[model samples]
Target: MKSVAHVYPWDIIGDPGAVQRILDLGVDAVALAASYHTVRAATPLHPEHRLVDARHAALYVPVREQAWGGRRLTPAEPSWVDGPDSYGQARDALKAAGLPVYAWTVLTHSSRLGDLAPEVVVRNAFGDRYPYALCTAQPEVVEYALTLVREIVEQGQPDGVVLEACGPLGFFHGGHHEKTEGGDWGKVRQALLSICFCTACAARCTEAGIEVDTLRAQVRNAVDAGEPDSVESALGAELASALAAVRTSVVAQLRALLVGEVRELAPQARVIVHASADPWATGPFATAAPELGVEVDAVVAMCWPGPEASIPGIEALRKLAPGTRIAGYVLALPPKPIEAAAMRAELAALAAAGVQEFHLYHAGLASGARLAVVREALDSLGQRP
Candidate 1:
């Protein structure tokens, strides 16, 4: 099976030894995060030892012009101590080390732009704008995403590009010292609140023969009453089916847009997408997989498992898109055991499930021991043909 590792550009710039250390891990390819959203504290080893505040950061690499395809795409704030073109530098260094690099691009999930243009943000049934999640139904958001992909393909010169959060991001966000309380909220409730009711999205639904106002009111009532499961039954099968299809279709169209843009702009670069096992509420895997076969080279399922974690989604996806490659994205750090044996078992199970490739979630944030676990797992998994 193919062995790949995900990494942040800061890790390479921050730590002088990062490249060698990664080479030591024995991965077949490296997935470098090209365009990422905001984060509080990140340590890039360039200046050595000091923690850098990378809040609402943009391209880790120095962009030649702040604009992509004549549109002004935001860059990471000046707080980044490294040079603006850090991405190119990092890719060059890794390439010199003989490791292939893929651009791990994140399309949405940006609070910085959302905060600046609240009008483009995703609004729920209650009309509360999620200041972090940008709605793709908005034309400008799609344009920016296209520009970002075009720039990465034309400039970065990566072996491939891995797209993550390529569609709308849900309410779940990682803020520093996050806190929450009250009822569990559950999957159904979260899904209800995650639906975007922005004018653009509503317009698309209307075009699909869906009554946006009625659907929105029903959703609002379901969420308010804490009766998410009852939502479908209340709406009746016909309306429910229409609403579900519309919601899923919105995300699929956005994914198709980006995939098409990349293929047209950078035909040589391989296109792999981060597809979640459960593609609902805020993701696009389930509904988009069939159409994606025409564009995507492979689907990397986010199956970060624990000791007893089961990956039924792998089989489910295989059935949905029979001939497409189904890769597994494993978490190398906490929430997952750091033991090499546990990690190996997880890899073994994924391989058994007919997963032809494995992409380790992250290499930068992982501790030395955790990384060692990853290395051990790769070593045990043997080589990919």
Candidate 2:
């Protein structure tokens, strides 16, 4: 509780005036999905105004995949500035009133719904493009991403740039499958869904002389037109080598991109990442250290609570970037007393584990007076509780 109270965006449906009340309760900031990411709706804005209510919110900007406004399409250039002069303009306007603003960007998550981006999107071994992804393996993809972040930084001038969850999509065989809220990413084996097997990804692996097809074949399960799918016939030999190559290359690239920027602009801004788990875990998350040039002071881990509540990741975070402080993520969506308790527990555990920063996913915790609980937590931090 010795740090600032960080939180999410308040999506006020009917009465917009209630936001101030929410912020009054120690909800130091708001992270919002600024605009929908769609082929048609290039830049995200509320339609009425492109600028988010920055004066009242701490921004965790929700970046869209290629397409956001229903249609799916990936622009050669990132479409974040169609509405405002720059994302930083919104940040600056908000900071005028003493707010902290960071460019909150997502990583390895390019699937929208039906079909948005195909080639430039996240694809499974099956080839069906998920809604939002830009293939992490493609050099072109990295270039586009860097260009956009640089634009936001050079023009927007945010307090810091946050890279959230950077890692390869799960691994797969000859290719991969996609997963949805529904189930399996078709043709692309069930194992391939969360995993990726894009040709570009394979090529990246091949450069290291790994067998791309062998890795792809390894994840393929035997599927009987009449019987349930089984992994018995699926999976190939010599696949791990290929999978390792893809994962390694992707992580290295992300780490380099993020840290490189921080080094270039450390005095003007910071380049950081938010990895609580999965993408940020060890092996898969080998990029957290300064070797990759990550901004240690600004890099933070959203150490949230799990059913079992392990701290290996947090400890790893501390070890990965010795000086970076972690902000344990407090889930506040429903705003229930139980959730508050969980947040409290997470904070307690993380702090005890030596984490100093705390970031609460704003939307979950800032509803009505439920945010009052957050205030209680922050008051304790400020020597008030």
Candidate 3:
């Protein structure tokens, strides 16, 4: 089994000991953020500064005018981190230390871009715009995602690429100080609310033989009634299935375009996606429906929900893409105790459930103690690659 640790450019840029600390973790590679959304990250072990407030979504690489010329949805350069090419600088240092690097590219999750172009963002069933989610149903958003990937592969020259939010984002916006929990919405209601009714999406659904207004009304009525336990129940079987087909189709098209771009740019680079087997899933881990035939080197399932939730997801993904490796996106941060035994058990459980890779989350933000626990857990699992 292989192990890859997630990190940021700021984690490596000014910290002399960053490379050595990462090496000590026994990871085979590092998934460094190439393009990322807003975050006030904590550099627990950096020598220069402790906190980095990335005020907006920005590309870590230098934003070339030629690459983004005439494009309205171009990526912004990071002002929080010093230097024009933080990704390049960090990539060079990690490569020098003999650690393979994967460009962790985030797509369709930029609030800054969405705010600038409201029409391109996701509009819910009630026509409420999610300013944080760039609706992939829009042609401009698709073009932006492709351009971003092209830049990362052509410039960053990574050994691999890990794609996040490769499809349309829905109601979830983590960093926006969300206040929706007050409504007491269940998982079913949340999924319903996630249904996009934007111009492009509605058109797509209509083309797929769905009544746009009727479906929207049904969605609203479902929310009001608050009776249905699942999306299928709320929208009725036929409508629900049709809606899923449309959603999955959108995700499938975007994934293919991005993956094709990556393959064309660098055939040797491994392609990994943060994904879910569930057809209705959205957000960072987009749906990797088996029927669509996910074409990637690996599928990384979010394992922060623990073994019970994560194991089944991994199993489902394994069945979906049997040829591709399954990676557990394991979390070692807060809410998860900094203990080797506990962490090792989770890793072991995932491995047993057919997870061929372990993708450790946030090596940059983790404290020395937390990192130590990660190292110990990997050591225990014999996962040092």
Better of 2 and 3 by lDDT: 3
1 or 3, greater by TM-score: 3
Superposed model 3: Cα runs more than 4 Å off:
292-294
User: Clash pairs of candidate 3?
Assistant: none
Report the Cα lDDT for candidate 3: 0.90
Report the C-alpha displacement of residue 4, candidate 3, in angstroms: 0.5
Q: Rate the local accuracy (lDDT) of all candidates.
A: 0.74, 0.46, 0.90
Model 3 residue 303 lDDT score: 96
Candidate 1 error regions (>4 Å): 41-47, 64-73, 174-177, 277-279, 283-293, 307-310
The clash numbers for all candidates, in the given order, read 11, 37, 0
RMSD of each: 2.7, 7.8, 1.0
Residue 168 displacement (Å), model 3: 1.1
**Which order, best to worst by TM-score?**
3, 1, 2
